[model samples]
Target: MKRIKNYFTIIAALIFFSGLADAQRSPQRAPQSKAIASSEDQCLFNGTYRIDVTESDRLYSVVEDARSSVPVRDQQQFFRDLSTRLTPPDMLAIECQGTRVTVGSSRAGKITYLADGINRRERLPDGSFVSSKITLGVDSLTFVSSGKAEDNVNVAFESLEDGRRLRVTRRIDAQQLPEPIVIQTLYDKISAAAEWNIYDGDRVAGKMGSAQPGAPPESNRAADALRSEFAIWIEATNRRDIAQQMRFYMDELQAFYLTRNTPKRAVRLEKERIFGSARSVDIRAGEPEIVFQNGGRTAI
Candidate 1:
């Protein structure tokens, strides 16, 4: 009886130790909490977006609306300052991580926000300062700015079309203004492969492709005019005429040169420095090829 009892005790100890080793080797995983899942859901706007010019309000109209309220004496100065503040960026890059969101704009630089409902003072590009707060919602992200004299601006961004498009709405209000200025803009999310379609009347006409279609008579004439203009510009460049080169661009022009989006003044300064430093310059430009787009109302 004693021998049998000893044999049973050894077997029981072996079984208990084996179970302990197995538990250490394969531990159970804790279920994910709801907070982590909600945090991930807030990243719907995480992508690069390009402004859709056709669907966005023109800057001229917005300026005109604001100009109506200002006095004639102050209109000129107010417009100068307002134009810089109201112009929308051409591209925006958005990043969402946890409760932090960062927005990078082509024109306005970059800004980071913590969506904790705390107001922070930030300086604008025009050197003016405003207190702003950013908040994240279920389906939209909002930014509100407050300035002096009851001046307030609200900007909201909402995802659309299954996150392929974004709608941005901006509202400006001030004590001097009788009515609020509201603007809505649309942006398209960029993807690895994208296609821009140009419509002609009721048909899809110019899809971006490698093959160049035969030019119409009107297109040929426009191409000739562009070539002539290009030749003149090239001549001016070789002669190092900064003023002549500058005449080719408009005041509101934004040129992408050397991988940077440079304004007209900066472009002029750069050209001036290059023209002044170089002793002899030889420039050769080929004939310009014009592609009629937007039903021939625009050309590229």
Candidate 2:
């Protein structure tokens, strides 16, 4: 009987030790999952992007308004120049690692900030100091910088279009100005393997191929045909030819008009009404930028 009791005790001890070992190993797996979550969260904003010049130019009115507030004097000319040439960097490279975020560009060099909501100070070339802070949110990242003269700048990067685009809003506040200068710009994420074709009114102006193997010849031909079709559509819209414009869209098409979706027939009727009422239509369309996706089956 004593031998039997000893065997049971040994088995109970083994089970307890095995559970303790599992408990220690479970915490190790938790940290790895956490790290994976962090990486996935950062992936949304981590990539190279190019500024959408056409979209950015649409917001130039805000810059013009701000420029009017400054005088022609040298001290104030700086403000004017800033407003006039407030062009965003042509290219932006973003990197996110743990609590650190880095934004780099040819114009702005490189800047690193901690997303811990703590203000960091750095001296400018003129020996003046500025305080800057960065905050990371669920879907946006905000950065604010202020100087001793009560002049401050705030920049926010928002992820839009399911992380395919970024909208950057900048606000400049100065003590001498009555209102802050606000400029908003859009950026399109550049895929590493993207193939771009530039169109100039139904003519292929240029083609940019990725470093990887080029798409099949058939695929390229199909893409070129689509590009040409798009250019012709734009030409039709510019000339206010409702019939030609309607040819590009399918009968069952649903077009997004401002805030709501309208069927193709309604779209045609609306276009007819507008074209009929207007004395003259002089629509100038910018160069179309096309990004091919789904193995050249879709373009956006």
Candidate 3:
């Protein structure tokens, strides 16, 4: 258990060390959506995800009393002020295994522990205490915490019908804001790294790694299909079939490409020229991953 204690002690260090920002970000690969898991799937969050600050849509509100306090008009400033809580690391990570979950990012580094059994504060070297609790259920993961500077914190993650994205509502209690600030942080679920292993105590295990290939064939087929499609696309980099290739992108993305790149015919000609000059495109895919968006979309 000494090792476990040491590991958690390291986690505390990360929790405190999150203040330091480092330049340069590595590329992230997301798993395709399972897209069709049964409703009884309790382990929907059993993977890692990269979260970003997308334009807020339908999310929880922060204006505690819209009538009493003036609404925050300057969205950029508001988001900037709440950057620490909203987006510090361009890409955020959430790892959930069984009932335990860890949320990691640039600013808050990382925090990992049992979901239902954690309720304590870790005193940092700076003589300040960071306290938090995690409560996991069938459909939601609730994290409640507060620090020396914070009055109260509530960040809730709700699982949609599909598992591609989670609706996050964060409420930070700081005296700096006009009132309690509520921010909507929607996290698009992505696939974890292939060859990445999850260590449970001393028992070593491989997840989405080569060693565990086809361990759960049914669940992995969708992810595999996505990979296969990508491989095919790579091989066909010099492909002239615009119709077939256009199918590679989502409608929203296709529309964006058409608009941003110019006329459809011109875009096709550009692709042809680019691919025609390429010698070969290499496919460097790792283990397969899966994510199911609520609207029946799959992203890999």
**Per-model RMSD to reference:** 22.7, 23.2, 15.1
Tens-digit lDDT track for model 2 on 1-300?
332233223222221111112112211222222222154355466766667766775433554445333344433334434443455655566666655565664243445555555566655445666666566654577777666433366778887887788888877665545677677878887752112121122212124344215656775566667768878887887788888999876655532322134578887887898788888866664544444445565554
* TM-score, ranked from best to worst: 1, 2, 3
Q: Which stretches in model 3 have alpha-carbon errors above 4 Å?
A: 1-41, 48-81, 88-93, 104-111, 125-128, 147-151, 192-300
lDDT of 3 by residue, 1-300 (tens): 332233234333333323211200112222223322223235565444444444443221333222222144543333323342343222345556565455654234455555553455656565766676656666677766666443356667776656666666766554334465566656555554311222121111113344234445544565557667876765555454556676665433333221432455665666677567778655454333333333224342
Give one digit per residue, the lDDT tens place, for model 1 in 33-88.
Answer: 33221464556777766677789987656756563455675554454444445666
Evaluation by TM-score, superior candidate among 1 and 2: 1
Of the candidates numbered 1 and 2, which has the greater lDDT value?
Answer: 1
Model 2 reaches what TM-score against the true structure? 0.48
Clashing pairs in 1: none
lDDT of 1: 0.56
Q: Which should have the higher TM-score, number 1 or number 3?
A: 1
> Considering lDDT, where higher is better, how would the candidates rank from best to worst?
1, 2, 3
lDDT of 3: 0.46
Top of the candidates by TM-score: 1
- 2 or 3: which has the higher lDDT? 2
